[model samples]
Target: MTNDKKRWLILILLAFISALLLAITSTAISIYLYGNKTYTAKAEAAIVLGAAVWGEEPSPVFRERINHAINLYQNQQINKIIFTGGVGEPNEAAEAIIGKNYALARQVKLNDILTETESRTTYQNLKNARSVADNSKLNKFLIVSDPLHMKRAVLMARNLDMDAYPSPTPTTRYSSLRSQIEFLIRETFFYFVYLVFQI
Candidate 1:
């Protein structure tokens, strides 16, 4: 190729890379900021996204989400709790069931809790929760999860046409700066991927 043509191509490539980086950086900032905010509005139910389950108990990360939902229920911000997750292995207990059991042990009434035990992903979580909501005549929902996970979760909920709001857990397992940064990076990439599929 000619010198001028080669130079122009390089410049174009550089510009494209720069723009992509800027977009990603801006998304990370937005996710970080948005996740940090918590919604306290009243809703029909608090949809708790599942995390890890340690045997029969909830993992620390999962416990926080369930605790946040219980708080919402106790505060009268929500009337029902919906837990969503399937088992990680074929014969293991589902994450949703584990969360429900945890809440029950903590005195959340059995009649007030619902579990969707077939979802293995965030998208599946909200999607399956929507079905439970429909059956129960629950309309609005507070989407509860870890702080850094709220942005993507809420976006997916909205995309599913759910009347959803963010309700991030104030206390998160990702407490250290290093852990938070790592979560932000992971969320940033997933958020961008979600946006792309949305388009």
Candidate 2:
């Protein structure tokens, strides 16, 4: 190849290698962070980040999150529960509202169920949850979600200045190594993007 073409090829090769290395490194770091179980004592509320709702019911993944929050409430670790999720469909109930109804049916009182039905994404969930918590003086929060999701969720919580504890569900559908790895990779990419561009 010509000298100019040879140099261009070398640079492109190096760039590709660098990108690959970064992806591997970030994925490893994300897996580590995803398993981290951060918590605090005497929290005022347990914030259940919203997930998909099947029809008018919380989806299995979302139910797992709500169950954890309910466990916290039962143990008195948190005084109240704040459910965050907006409606995904035009006529379906908001995720938070659906979760609240579920909790109430499970014997959690309506008075202690706080709903933030204006957020549909994780970032929005925490932002809207923080607003609801602040209005009710439930400042400290135990954030509940799938284990692999806590890393980014906690990062966003910190950015929003919310006193959030990363309390991931004890078990989730992403239990297999393959599923876990997939989630880790996706989270790493998004986390990196969020860090670099604040998107």
Candidate 3:
């Protein structure tokens, strides 16, 4: 290869290595940040971020999060459960309704649960939940979601000045790998933008 071509190849290889290293580092940080059990101490509430619902029923992903939250409630790790999510597409049930009904079916008392049916994204979920928490006089909370999704949720909660800990629900092995990779990339880009513009 020509010297210029060889140099370009080396630069490309370095860039690829750097990207790979960054991905690995981010994944490790996510696991570390999200894998801990944060509900060991009693909290005022546990918030289960919403996933998609199918025809007014909780999807498997949403069920997993609700199950985790229910476990926490049953164990007295949290005093209340907050289900957050709104209907985004027609024909799909609101996530909060699906979550509330699922817990109710499991015999969780209706009075013990609060629903925020206005948030359509993780950021909004935290935003709406924070409002409820503030009004309820809850200063600490455990935020529950899929392990891979918890990092962003935790960061968003902290950015909103909420004292939040991550309590990730069980996810199918490899189910989140692709989406996690995409999220990591997108988050990195956005992080840089936020740093630059403080947005």
| Top candidate (lDDT) | 1
Ten-residue stretch with the least lDDT total in model 1: 190-199
Clashes of each: 0, 0, 0
lDDT of 2 by residue, 60-88 (tens): 88898898888888988988999999989
- For candidate 3, write residues 38-150 as lDDT tens digits: 54788889999988888878888788889989999999899899999999689777899889999999989998888889998778899999998787788889999876566
List lDDT for all candidates, in order: 0.92, 0.86, 0.81
- What pairs collide in candidate 2? none
**If scored against the real structure, what TM-score would every candidate get?**
0.97, 0.89, 0.77
Residue pairs with colliding backbones in model 3 are: none
Candidate 1 overall lDDT versus native: 0.92
RMSD of 2: 2.2
Candidate 2 off by > 4 Å: 1-12
